[model samples]
Target chain A: MTFVAATGRAFLVLLEATGALAIFTASALSHSVRPPFYPRLILRQMVDIGYYSLPVVGLTALFTGMVLALQSYTGFARFQAEGAIATVVVLSVTRELGPVLGGLMVAGRIGAAMAAEIGTMRVTEQVDALTTLSTNPFKYLVAPRLIAGLTMLPLLVLVADVIGVFGGFLIGVYRLDFNPASYISRTWEYLEAVDVISGLVKAAVFGFLIALMGCYHGYRSRGGAQGVGTATTNSVVSASVLILVTNYLITGIFFSTK
Target chain B: MPDSTPSQPAATPKIRLRGVRKSFGPKHVLNGVDLDVGTGESLVIIGGSGTGKSVLLKCILGLLEPDGGRIEIDGEDTTHLRPRDRERVMRKFGMLFQGGALFDSLQVWENVAFGLIQGERMGRREAKDIALRKLAQVGLGKEVAELFPAELSGGMQKRVSLARSIATEPEIIFFDEPTTGLDPIMSDVINDLIVKCVRDLGATAVSITHDMASARKIADRIAMIHQGRIVWQGHASEIDRSGNAMVDQFVHGRADGPIQMEILHP
Candidate 1:
């Protein structure tokens, strides 16, 4: 009986959370299309979400690609398939590693900052002040963030894909003694447009999830400092998990065979 | 005289709340409160901590939805208004929050001009000029206009918040704990500024504070809330002579009275 009760409670919590997120998403999307658009606010968010995040996302992609190349060489050499390293590196980075890893890294950096800043505004009555001042908090705060995240993450993932493939190329040539020209040709030959396009689609979804989670948690935060801290942690954790889950689901849709 | 009777029917209330109720889970905060503020009247609500004064104000401000009841502004039923209608109604309001609640990211002038630019659709140059004048009204210099909220002291921040609230020359203003964390002198200074600002705007003002000095200085009439109900409300001068035990206890800062603090027993 207790097990049944606990399961029911968990299901109920999930349902409530889903409902809240759906409503928030609708509000954000609707407001983004409405007038009184704050171009300045949107541009500022773009800088915060997209430009400032370049170094961390770039480094993560570069290192992941390098390590992937080295590890694939070690394993494939045992199977007498060392020449497949370039194809594997390019495909994996463009289709999987680049968007997923970059999304997770950005979820940590930008998602957490959004939660902290918005949560502080919530606790301090600044949000309430916005309402009194005749500005819709959702339109003023959440819409710009959603717009920036929706547009910016794909750009970041595209850059990450290029940097990651470059990292793999350097490793294949310098460490594994592969001919640099053939390695480069093989990477380009196997890399279809679908691989890069699918990753970018996933990047867009991950971006939306990150911004939505941050704004949702922060807007609902109660108490004070402790609540803001909890919101920040929840934003990053939820966004990272959602990114991984959705990545798998999206991958299945793009690549699964009947 | 107390003037507790409803005003003449010809003069509609600037704000009217009838049987308004709000609750958070099982803890009922505002349980059917009824109050009215005449046009251009300054009404201050005084209560102990956690007595739902802020909740009451938020309900009227459209920041919180009441569980049940009607809130009328200038005889218009503002309860349960749609988003667009709510925004239309909110244009008449200005608020000075307890912690100042100034946007730390914006300079003081920008903070004052936020509503002017964002809500009124005024040009930046014109709004900044008006922001400067409002700052001057609050006794803040033009030098302070370029600084952020974090750079200013608490008193200065409060003054800046006061300036922002009055920047639009709103028809209604709400002050939430206008002197909570200030020293006595600063509190009195804020009280004086509030009184002057409300008078100068001829605005209907609703303020919630536990500061009796502030209440006395700014309020034409005062209401005391206990357990989500207005227990006693009268002219500010009649507060001491009202003969209500709860009002007396709260007004005199007494520990022993009908109103008991909930201290946990070991």
Candidate 2:
């Protein structure tokens, strides 16, 4: 009976958290579109979320592309299909690896930072101070982040896609001794618009979700240093999980053939 | 307990709370607190820690919604104002938080000018000038305005926070533990600055503190809260002779009294 009760209580907590998150998301989004928009704050967040994240995302894409090209060469060599390396590299990066890996990287970087910053504010009564100053915390804090995340993630992924495909090109020409022209040609020949578009769309969704989790956890954080630390961990963990889950769901929507 | 409300019977109190109650799940932080602060009156609430002092202040600030109560501001019921109306109501008030609560990301002057530039939509250059003036009002120099909150000492930060609170010239100001963690001399300095600032603006002031010195120095009227309710309130001069058991025990700082701390026995 105790075990049953514990399980029920756990479910209740999850249900309550989900409802709370839904309401928070709705409020943040609604506040984002309303009057009294802070373009300056949004621009600042854009720089933090987008500009600062470029190096890590770029390096991740470069290494992943290089490794992908070499690995694909090995696998396709078994079937005497070495020519398919370019197609596989470009398709995988644009369709799955680019958006998925970039989202996860950003979740670790920006999500944790957002949670820590806002959590500190929450614990120290800065959020309450904002309310007292006649400034809505949603508009001042959460909306700028939401706008930045939604707009910047797709841009990051777009850059990632280019860098990733180029990394594959480097490996194919320099290491694998393939004809550079033919490899480059094959990279684009099979790459349809849907593959890249679907990934960008996924990036947008992942970005918004990342910001939502960070802001929600940080805004609701209680206590002191310990509470802020917990919020930071929850922000990154929840964001990465949501990215993976939503990636699969969005891929199914875009690519599944019945 | 007799309250100071009788002294200001004719004017609507700047802030009035009747049976204000707040709780967090199993814990009842505020049972039913009733209090009043007269227009332009500096009222200081004194209480032991965890006796719902901060919670009571926050409920009035609308940061924490009370579970049940009637909160009135200038004779208007403000317990259930809509978001738009709440923002309008919030404009009339300013606060100096315990830790200063300065936005660490912004510069000292930016922190002071935040409400002016954001809430009132004042021009940045105009706001900056006012921010510097307010900083000077609190004994800070123009050079200090460019520095961040983290760079400032605790006393300087509190001064900057005071400047920020009065920058908008609010009609009412609230201070939460204005002297906690400060040295005795600095605490007294802050208490004096608070008194001067409130008097200069002719703003109603509500402050919560356990520091009796601060309460005495800054309050025209003093209220004592025990177990989530206001048990005694009168002129600040009469606090020492209140004769109430809780007030007597708390004012004298006696541990073995009617009010018990939840210390574990071996």
Candidate 3:
């Protein structure tokens, strides 16, 4: 096929696959609402996919928060407005950087593994075995992951916000010689409930997107080793893109001038 | 030869397929295929690579929707069923995949007890107890119960797969490539385990394997698939002389035959 034709075909496949994924995801959600919710399985998945992922998310948040503080202090120092470092750091962690950084870190860490593992299962007929055994593979596999992603991401973001803010305070107090108490006061001075809420909301959405992309790409994977590799790459790319796009939309919703 | 006394249902067949046709895109995988499995019978499906045997098993499991056919289990049409209803039907089946396909996150006991624990929702202690018993039945030590799939050797993994298959005591069992890559001794062990396991469950088995020794050891009847159709089928004892040219060529493992003539070479 010609390049244009091949590209068009691939795009069409993407659209069809996305539609199928949406349908499957909707089915899982519907099943989740009904009887026989697997609490033990959901808790295990939360511990695995969410709690175990904290160190990476925490480290990413810490560095990002510290770097934001340092950069903001320098930029504000040029205008003799260095005290604004506190506001910048607090806003950065609670508003934009915290959730985005946590999501990117998770996309790299958890998303790729989920895709590779589930894609291997797909190619290997394990999923079909589950079906033949009278188990809904979605309920057994996808639902728990989805529940973990949507529920535990917010909790991770909460921890990230606290550690991130502290990282900023550390940078301000030690590096820039700002008064510690004054930094805390300025950080809290202009903060609103909506700011924190929006970040948590983004975290939850990004978690859903990341897990969704991973499972969808994996479950749809074909062939063997090569197919799984392609699925993993697509998962990361799709999730990262969705995170950025959703970030813009969410930010615009919360802070856009009327 | 416990079941060799002659099955009453063998004359009438416990499972039947009629004109089962399936095509993936332009590639027709199963073309007008027909097969039958007797009650309490161990049937082996033998075919070369890319012969659509896997696809055939998937179709019977209702995992892949076939384009045209009638698949009847106990003389009931199971070809078309809603998802929920199909799940109810699936309770009767247990499958052993080529790779074992054990869930790596789950312990050996949990993996064996998956169908019972998740599908039937038996209590964990009871499930674990039963799981260990099944593992014991498969000759796996009780100490292997707590380890994850990644911790097991390849042979152990296959045994776990067998234990998991018989855990629910299914009416039908499907074994895909049961002894594909195992050593000769391990292959004999697995074949023996399969006999013990299926006989213990009284399951009507439909196993697809190219292993001739596995076929001879594990089957009461044998069917050979080629190019998506059953080229030959007969009692396992009669396989050495099925009076069909394709069966003769396939059994003798010959390169030059009607099969060679039929396959394309560009």
| Winning model by lDDT | 2
Worst 10 residues of 2 chain B by lDDT: B1-10
TM-score of chain B of each: 0.97, 0.97, 0.94
Residues B133-189, model 2: lDDT tens digits: 999999999999999999999999999999999999999999999999999999999
* lDDT values for all models: 0.92, 0.93, 0.88
TM-score of each: 0.97, 0.98, 0.92
- Candidate 2 docks at the CAPRI level of high
Clash pairs, candidate 1, are: none
**Model 2 C-alpha lDDT per residue in residues A92-182, reported as the tens digit of each score:** 9999999999999999999999999999999998998888888999999999999999999999999999999999999999999999999
Best model per TM-score: 2
Candidate 1 per-residue C-alpha lDDT over A1-258 given as tens digits, one digit per residue, 9 for 90 to 100:
999999999999999999998898898889889987999999999999899999999999999889989999989999999889999998999999999999999999999999999999999999988888888899999989989998999999999999999999999999988899999999998789989999999999999999999999999898999999999999999999999999999999999973
Cα lDDT tens digits for candidate 3, A1-258: 699999999999999877897897898787766666778888987897688889998988889889989999779999999988889888889898889989988887878888898899999888887887788878777877788888888899989999999999999999989899999999999889998999999999998888888888888899999999999999999999999999999999989983
The residue-by-residue lDDT of candidate 3 on B79-145, one tens digit each, is 9988777987798889999999898778999999999988898999999999999999889988999
Flag clash pairs in model 3: none
* Model 1 misplaced regions, further than 4 Å: A1-4, B1-10
Question: What DockQ does every candidate get?
Answer: 0.90, 0.90, 0.69
Q: Against the correct fold, how does model 3 do in TM-score?
A: 0.92
TM-score pick, better of 1 and 2: 2
Ranking by lDDT: 2, 1, 3
